[model samples]
Target: MTEEKLQDDIGVAAATEASPEEKSLREKFGDQVLSVSAGLDCEVVVLARECIAEACHYLKNTLGFEQIMDLCGVDNSALPGWSDASPRFEVVYNLLSVSKNRRLRLKVGANERDLVDSVTEVWPTANWFEREAFDMYGIIFNHHPDLRRLLTDYGFEGYPLRKDFPLTGRVEMFFDEAQWRCVYRPNQLTERVLVERTWPGVDRG
Candidate 1:
């Protein structure tokens, strides 16, 4: 095959598909399906971290769920007791079927160290989803092609969306004659500098 055709084939393979079985399974699972804010138009399913890869396999091969509309990760670090050792981060997958005009949602949860199994083998679009999740939430997607920062700079430290992250942020930049990049994560706020102090200390005495 030509280069262009090969590229197209790869792209098409990654695309998602919706099917009739999705609708049937959605009804069967009921509330466990985990539909989000979209009343009834959207479909969702929540699954255990260990089962996510398997779930995707089932939805795709058994139910004809060919299209993976979106794959995203959510950080629940704000919740007390959330830790790297326990399942906290959630990975969400959206599936669609063109032939049946139906949609489905799937989810999996994991802790900091836990690596969610890769679905890229099943849905090619999952390649980017897993990358984004790893980039933003620090969740690992095992067996991904390129599991690295997708949006953040190479030197970025921690996940910005985490509740503990400061609003001003701790981004570091070169501010000295040496021009060497250094860590700028400030621990205290008031220690930086006060605006009034720059006005040349008034001689009240």
Candidate 2:
């Protein structure tokens, strides 16, 4: 057999069929799973908020998606049709199975003030990832041991990744020579209009 044929065979064997994975989720969670996107590169399963923790546990132990590769929050507030949608935040989980060379993704939604259960207990490595999501998107993870900001300063005012956050930001930092430290103050950059002229297809009237 040629090298290319061997690689093709490996690719076929490594990825699990999408149907079985979706079927397994249905067997376990029934309608709690909102949707499944199974692609050649990876598979994604979206679960109800209350089912996230339980589904994570099942995937790690039962489905053999042993590693939690990444976790991040998505702010849908500014999406064209999602402005008024409830559960304004979505957290995506990336799971990898090294033994099988397969990958999966899980997503769940959270309302503005609602908190999702923490998966740190299942995957200890999720500690920092969860904190970063909380810091950037302001999505709370319930039962998280330390839910403080991971990337931002001690008193950062707003969630920087949220679409509504000002492009220039709420504050700017500078070193105060007299005080021998840094201080943050309201942004001083003057706002400038980028587009002064109206173009075709635009309703200027």
Candidate 3:
């Protein structure tokens, strides 16, 4: 699609209600969609990870969710950690229903080594979005034509967005003019709290 075609989609209004679509989806894929929660301005559907691609297809083809607005990954390690705290990661997709003027949010849980089905075939723009998620969270996208890092180098070591990845990163890269190529070395930055904490109970008078 060209720029002019894209402009037409932007002018479409967002649908405030998804009751009809929700009913249709719930009836057809009750097992796949775990829950449906609607708010004042938005609706979210928690779906099973194994059937995300199929669910998205139904939404776009039948429910009139014509456009995929955005897709990104989330790291949930900080929220809570336990023996069976849900998956450590989640991939979120935002869809726009131009015809119905509705917006829907889809999310699927992903584990450390699991791969989610690539939605590129359904929405070509998902190509870059899925790559970005994989690059940042190491959440693989199975069957993506070109699944590569979007923001990081080809040989980047770890998923920078993971909560465990140090704020300073695992390695530091610098241009090595001596050898005429960039080089990475063990990160040298360290954490040190320079400010002293003052308790409210301490007498300052």
Best by TM-score: 2
Candidate 2 residue-wise lDDT, 16-63, digit = tens:
455666788899999998988765677778899998888888888988
Better of 1 and 2 by TM-score: 2
Rank ordering of all candidates by TM-score, starting from the highest: 2, 3, 1
What tens digits encode model 1's per-residue C-alpha lDDT throughout 1-205? 8999999988776543433444555554544444333325564556656666766787788777789988887877666556666567788788887876778777677777888899999988888877888877788888888898989876788877665666566654445656554544444443343443322355645
Model 3, 136-178: lDDT tens digits are: 9999999999988889986888898997888788788999999
User: TM-scores of the models, in the given order?
Assistant: 0.64, 0.82, 0.81
Q: What do the candidate models score in CA lDDT, each in turn?
A: 0.70, 0.87, 0.85
What C-alpha lDDT, on a 0 to 100 scale, does residue 3 get in candidate 2?
100
Deviation of model 2 at 77, angstroms: 1.2
How many residue pairs clash per model?
A: 14, 0, 3
**In candidate 3, residue 32 scores what lDDT?**
84
Error of 1 at 143 (Å): 1.3
RMSD, every candidate, angstroms: 15.8, 7.1, 11.0
Model 3 Cα displacement at 79 (Å)?
0.4
**Model 1 lDDT at residue 60:** 81
**Cα deviation of 188, candidate 1, in Å:** 9.0
Q: After superposition, how far is residue 167 of candidate 3 from its true place, in Å?
A: 1.1
